[model samples]
Target: MEALNLTSSGPTTFILNGIPGLEAAHIWISIPFSVFYIISLLGNFTVLFVVAKEQTLHKPMYLLLCMLALTDIGTSTCIMPKALCMLWFGSKYITVDGCLTQMFFIYMIAIMHSAVLVTMGFDRYVAICDPLRYATILTNARIAKLGLVGLIRAVLLVLPLPLLLRRLPFCANRVIPQTYCEHMALVKMSCGDTIMNRMYGLVLTFVIMGSDLTLIGLFYGLIIRAVLRISSKKAHQKALNTCSAHICVMVITCATSLFPALTNRFGQGIAAHVHTLLANLYLLVPPMLNPIIYGVKTKELRDKVGKYTCRM
Candidate 1:
């Protein structure tokens, strides 16, 4: 309910340091980043297209996969282009408004990604534990509402961040030591009392993401217990296989995302370039890997992709 609408003694333009000590390798670095970006685009778009064309894939699980593809697209697109621009062309300056807008979308997608994973976890839990009610419980309307709630949660929580920054007086040290505008990075730039900013950001991130991951783990724990109760070994194997891909994705996304945040906040002995590099990789890994994991693991989607590829 509080608002910080006044702009303070902060610089209107902020400089994004692409990499602290690797300016020369910036061009070389662009190569791999570009590859990851292209792969993410192709892979995610393929999933969206395949899901759209195949009517039989219109169930809750596949609908959730489409949501994952969209968020994956968002996650990479939000970070990669700005980073690539800084790397390739040395265009590292961002306006305060520009910086704030970028921060909103980046963190929004990050939150939504966690929510989608949580929803997917719920979907699996229902499918594994309450198979008879899976369809009835997760109708199209329910899925849409869940996605909408995630969007609303992300927006309401992240909206205050930029507004909070507006109230702070940033010193003349306007160089942000990364390729993109991150919340803590921007907060650290301020010379004013930013206890509120730090507290809000920490709570927003740790609470939302931490709870999502915990729910995912809990979902799997229940799923594993249910599978064990099955008398047939073959049935247990089938159930485990169904969850393997989603769990693998959660592990990859969870580690890559959390580690960089940890490195950003508390990695005192860590080098500046290490933080920058990890942040860049953090943005790239999940998008590039998600569709591939699903494509390999989900048989129906895999078959559709294979048939589409063969026709191509």
Candidate 2:
């Protein structure tokens, strides 16, 4: 589908309205983003490689990690290539269809990432909360099923967004201010009121992100309660350590998703941009850091990665 020409005022135009004092900001942003992109790619690839090669790490936890790496890689690949292209090539004019497609995949992956995090939380809870039944509850077949369900869910949840946009009469401006076509941002550009789009988006936010966060909170809370009752210091410490990486990931994801909306509501453009940068970081930084977090904390992954790399 062609990009919706909704701009009522005229044909959508993307003029670079240069921000004062931010002349060098693009350069600064590009440097860090480039570094983050490289790290994210390398780190996730390493995780994927190690998990694929090491038979010992073929358990549920590592399987979930492989999924996480795959999602992270998908996320960075979605945003970074276009972003870097804009920075290096000075090409920011995306067609309406291209913009919609970008939004679709980005939203799909983001929702899927959240779902995967929730699944990981559940996996941890089962391992800690019901160790005796963990194996039976999270079997290889079950994990495969859960993963397939997550994939379908993400696609289903985000697919309708573009269709909804396609239904809207494009009477006005086509130029999106941001580098990427965010759903809400595009909706805002509509000449006609977008009450239905907003309502749908709110419902989606509650269902996908809100539900995932609630489940993650419950899982962590239960884990905390379980850990407190354990008498052995080492046992409690080990349980907490297992959760550290997930907790960091959760915090980053939540901040990235929630903060921008809040800042935008308050009319803070700079804050919104900062939030955008943080949102990108949630995809890039956490993925890059995940390997380090797991490797430093888990002796098994660390040893395996070192041995595996040394052999090469």
Candidate 3:
């Protein structure tokens, strides 16, 4: 049915690759992927639920944690089902419209994920540098507006990508060597020159992610400066402890996301299947680990989770 719809006159469809030359092992591969996906869902959902249940946890940091969980869910949702379908059911076709829709969400989620991290960094900064003003600075309404701004930014930046991609005519090659509709993979399927598309993707990624990372770094720098000035050794250790979890999360997420993009663009000698696997890792790792890191590192959230579990 999908193959029948690849004509230029109507709509275009492309076949998704699970792994080149590893068709026989797709089912085997699905086992671990599915497990990771399930664990991520359970973990992130627990975060959302606990945050909602505990009134005391209704602070700026926890609210931002909720945003992180939401983005994690979004990242996984955009990739996992289609990936699992391709792996398990041997269904691997994505219509042009469907592919574009998926691409938009994937890009938006990534940008928003970065935004949430930066916002969390800001939360930490305010808490440390201006503890008395933290409440007034990051009010509930202000937090909501900050999230809305991030959403708007993500939409405006990602909106052009799908529009730019639509102008490319399919060159009769409908096979994309990845489970999901990655931008470069889709760009390669076009008959036209993809240099501009590649350039736009590269520039936007650097400008937005680069800007976010810079702001986050600046926030941490100020936070550290403030922390070091504190006379009490106990206060110094406490402040550093508060930031350690956020730093760990930031490092894990940024590395997983940026490395695959960089490697995809520059690492020509690498294998295609390896790139695909890395892309999947980019989507999976942040969602799977963020909750665990927070739960282990933050005592309040951890205690709430333990009590909630005992009751259940």
Candidate 4:
């Protein structure tokens, strides 16, 4: 069994504080979480299947949509199984290696999801801003290459984290305060100094996610400008409507992720937990809601899903 090594001289035991006035909180959350998990799984699977089955969706946009669905499935799978276990069994203690492994996959998928969003932004930019060159710019070969590059970058960026965690000399406190194996939370339990881990984390965040966010913002800015220059009122409305879903996703993700990091740095535990909950929501909510959003917002996907489901 994997165990966290604590640095203290005496025997160590872990105790978790049961929440006051929220004895049923776990039960309450479980109901919606279970529902969302089912919906998210089915919805994302349908997306993957529809994209694979339909030759028409072989284009760049649908390819990115498929990638997004895959990432969503991955992200939720990493967290929900353990989360549900915690809810049902009231067991939150995770072994050291297990925690590190969980952290690795969670961060990997989260970063990859962000990278895919940047790719999606570029897809929209080319489709809208450079309509004349969209086909040439985002060809099948190019899309495939982009996917490969995203996968490579995600792996490379997260590779160091687990190695770094393993190198740390953990002193006695093996118990993680949070339900899930969050990277910073694990580091916090360490009795030794975690300056290196913190520094590495900061570098990874800014280098990968920060850069991607900047590029995505730039792409959308150009897209908005291009949209504004259009002469027809109906065309402008259509363009804005198409952009809204992605914009909402971007805002939700960034706010959830960035806020927690900030609050943690400021040593605000309650604020950090709230942000963590929001971040978890940001991760799950989009996956659950994306299909619904796209279905209601985009006539093509909605019609396709409806027809496909009806046939089934």
Q: Which stretches of candidate 3 lie over 4 Å from their true place?
A: 1-11
Q: What are the models' TM-scores?
A: 0.96, 0.89, 0.96, 0.88
Give candidate 4 misplaced runs (Cα > 4 Å): 1-24, 267-276
* Model 2 lDDT per residue over 122-237, tens place: 99999888999999899867877888899999999899899888767654455455556678777766766678888888789778877888999999999999999999999998
Candidate scoring better on TM-score of 1 and 4: 1
Clashing pairs in 1: none
Each candidate: how many clashes?
0, 10, 0, 4
**lDDT score at residue 247, model 4, on the 0-100 scale:** 80
Q: Comparing 3 and 4 by lDDT, which wins?
A: 3
Give per-residue CA lDDT, model 4, range 1-312, as digits (tens).
233453253224332212223446877776777788889899889888887888887888888888888888998888788777777778666655576778888888888888889988998888888789999899877877888888888888898888877666665555555556777776776666789899998888778767998999899999989998999999998888877778877876777667666665664656444645654665577788776666677676777888899997
Would you list the C-alpha lDDT of every candidate in the order shown? 0.89, 0.76, 0.89, 0.75
Q: Mark the regions of model 1 whose C-alpha exceeds 4 Å error after superposition.
A: 1-10
Cα displacement (Å) at residue 217, model 2: 1.5
After the best TM-score superposition of candidate 1, give how far the Cα of residue 291 lies from its true spot, in angstroms.
Answer: 0.3
Off by over 4 Å in 2: 1-24, 266-272
RMSD (Å) per prediction = 3.1, 3.5, 2.4, 3.6
